[model samples]
Target: MFSYNVNEEIQLRLLELRHTDELFALTDGNREQLRQWLPWVDGTVDTEHTKRFIQSTLAAFAGNNGIQAGIFYKGNMAGCVGLHGIDWGNRKTSIGYWLGAEYQGHGIMTNACGTLVNYVFSELNLNRVEIRAAEFNTRSRAIPERLGFVQEGKIRQAEWLADRYVDHIVYGMLREDWSMNGQASNRFEVETDE
Candidate 1:
């Protein structure tokens, strides 16, 4: 299991099928808020949908592709953060994340992302880590910006939400940049050894 004990208040754990109910409930409760930026909100209609999503995440881990973890705030489900996928040939991976509506303003994602970037560039030795946030989503875009990610460019109509296409602002940090800038090196204790 991949678990990061980020602090006394925030932690991240691997998503499992057993967490379907809790995860689904979180998603259901934030459906309106999430639907604004996330394209898959309507599709995640029940626990079974969340179960299959967890199964896929597990399979990705087993196949050494990537991972997704459930964000825990004071031991409660908050959201998720993970590598969307790894480009092994290029040693690059894109990070994706979302937080529960109520969890905003706590800086949960900023620290969670810092932990993941540290793991990716330091431990995994990945060359590049990318974070793409929808152009209009200021809150989402701030995570990478606060962490010193360089804005690469914009991809028009990158994703389709419920009603329309949203442009994505790509931010990238290279291995050299991470080392030189000291991007995400705050203390994040791992509960389980990798």
Candidate 2:
């Protein structure tokens, strides 16, 4: 599990069923803001559903499959960040994240991503991590650029969402690159095992 306080105004907190209610509220509050990026928001979200979702995530973490955390700004849930579809044998992981529109353009995602990537490299000992985003999502694309991740390639029609296929831009960074850049923050370790 990971935990950290970002200055006095925000924190990156790990998720648990205990926080499911808050998570559901935040997700629901940001549904339209997240709909473009997240398919799960297509349906209604309730405490029970989100609670079960969190349970599944915890179970995945317990099985060494993935981990998800709630983004907190000033003690309130803002959005979600997660590492999923992990391939431990290959020493690789993928990051997925979103912030409420209200929190966008505040450098919150950059800070959150930097904090998570540092943990992934230094703590989890991952060889490489990648982020895939819709090609036209400039805000999402900017994260990799700001974080020094190289745009490896584009996977054409890689994902089908909302009845349409979309191109995905793949961006990646390695531990060596991260170390060379000295952008790794010494915070919590990335727990692939949750």
Best by TM-score: 1
Candidate 1 residue pairs that clash: none
Please give, for residues 1-194, the per-residue lDDT of candidate 1 as tens digits. Answer: 79998788999899988889999999999999989998888999988999999999999988888989999999899999999888999999999999998888778888898888988987788999999999999989988888889999999999998889999999999989887886656743323111
| 139 Cα displacement, candidate 1 (Å) | 0.6
Candidate 2 has an lDDT of 0.80
lDDT of each: 0.88, 0.80
> Against the true structure, what is each candidate's TM-score?
0.94, 0.90
Which residue ranges in model 2 land beyond 4 Å of their true spot?
Answer: 185-194
In candidate 2, list every pair of residues with a backbone clash. none
TM-score (C-alpha) between model 1 and the true structure: 0.94
